[model samples]
Target: MPFKKYLLTGLMVWLPLAITIWVLLWLVGALDAVFGGLLSVINSVAPVAITVWSEKLRNIPGLGVVLVVSVMLVTGALVSNVAGRWWIRQWDRLFTNIPIVKSIYNSVKKVSDTLFSSNGNAFRTALLVQYPRAGSWTIAFQTGVPGGEVQNHLGADFVSVYVPTTPNPTSGFFLMLPRSDVIELQMSVDEALTYVISMGSVAPSLPAATLQKPKP
Candidate 1:
């Protein structure tokens, strides 16, 4: 029994580290594969000396990630100028003129802009709400209020919230509830996410003001 307990404890300590390393290795392999494919295409029509060098470059570990990052940095720098803006507008126009591609591209672009823009309000606040049934509470995030015809029907007192599932936060339910029913939390969005993803095993500490005892 003692040996079994010890083995279980050791596994608890090492499991998280093992999974983290495995995920990182997978990401590196995927990036390397992209670069390898590009080199393979180039090798088809190039001189023998050039093809040899491309193959050698593909074998270098982490080079693909480095090259991709460098390209992003250079692209960002270029896009910060006036001419770059003009070109980007032209690029968007070209894409937007396409039939099927425009619909997909525009939908994705709108979602990305809302999620990643500096001034966007999505996921900015954490809330405590009763979900699935009354008297049962869960952590949720404010993703913005209802819009368009839904807003017209729901009125001004409703908000949109996302409740993420435990252990895997990617998939979740979206609820539009009355603002009065949701209690705003002092904890940050990141803290709330950690709590939810840990299945309430981890909780954010109370704010300093909440910790102070009231004078009798």
Candidate 2:
């Protein structure tokens, strides 16, 4: 019984840290793959004399990290100026004029906007929504709205949502649900995410106002 108690305590302590490390590892692996692909493209376009040196640099430890940082710095500058954006838009227009590149660039732009844009509406809220069936509710997030004439056709305040799976919240569904059906939680977005990712093991404590309220 004493041994079992110790094991349980140990798990309680290390479980969250273990999960966080796993998530960090997954992000690192994904970024490494993306940056490596970008480097490969750049290398293919480089001249013969520069190609050999670039290959050697690419193989070095932490070289990819340096290249990633350099790219980020350049991007930061680009978005900070009128000329830089003008040049970027010109390049985008050029790509859009091409047959094959147009499709790829457009798709990439759409995905980037969805994932990274603040105003894009993905992962905007943590709410309670009836899912799997009515009378049963689940935690989900607001993704966005149905644009154009779709709202007029549906005749409802509809917003996009993401219903995450247990253990790993990265995988989920993109749904469109009516605004009236969603129960907005008072807890913060980060707190809600923690609760969902922990499979209800961790939750945000009730506010003082709610906790102290007396029953009539």
Candidate 3:
């Protein structure tokens, strides 16, 4: 029993590290595949001296990730300019003219903008809400305050909460609960996500003040 316990303990220690390494390797491979094609095209069109160096660069593992990061930085810098904004708008307009591609591109672009923008309001806080039934609570992310038609219909102060499912945080239910019903927590979005993904096995530590009863 002791030996078996020791083996299981060892596995627990190594399994997470192994999976992390595997995921990282797979990501690098995927990036290499995407950038590899562009690199090949560049090499073909480049001068003989540059082409020789590019061919060597192409063989180096993880070079694609570096190039991709550099490209993203340069693209971000360019897009921050007025001329670049005009060019991007024109390019976006071209995509918007396409029927099927327009819908998909616009939806994805909106989501990406909301999630990545520094001023965006999505997932700003964690909350404890009674979901599915009363007296049963779950961890939820505060997406934002309700607005538009939904807000007008509700006619009350309501907060938009996203209750993510166990193991897969991407898919979840969006609920609009009265502000009073939701308990705001000091724990961060990342900490709440870890607690959810671990299915309550991983608990986040709370401050003593949070645990203390409020003054009467």
Cα lDDT listed for each candidate? 0.92, 0.82, 0.90
Name model 1 segments beyond 4 Å from true: 1-9, 213-216
Residue-wise C-alpha lDDT for candidate 1, range 1-216, written one tens digit per residue:
999999999998998899999998888889899999999999998999999999899889988888888998988898899998899889899999999999999999988888888898889899999998999999988888999999999899999999988888889999999999999999999899989877888889989898896867
lDDT rank order: 1, 3, 2
Error of 3 at 171 (Å): 2.1
> Weakest 10 consecutive residues, lDDT, candidate 3?
207-216
**133-213, model 2: which lDDT tens digit per residue?**
999888998877877788787766888788998877889877788899998777878888888888998889997889999
Off by over 4 Å in 3: 37-58, 211-216
Better of 1 and 3 by lDDT: 1
For model 2 the local lDDT of residue 19 reads 79
What value does the lDDT take at residue 14 in candidate 3? 100
Candidate 2 residue 84 C-alpha distance from true site, Å: 1.0
- TM-score of each prediction: 0.88, 0.79, 0.82
Error of 2 at 93 (Å): 1.2
| Clash pairs (backbone) in predicted model 1 | none
- Cα TM-score of candidate 2: 0.79
CA lDDT of 20 in candidate 2?
82
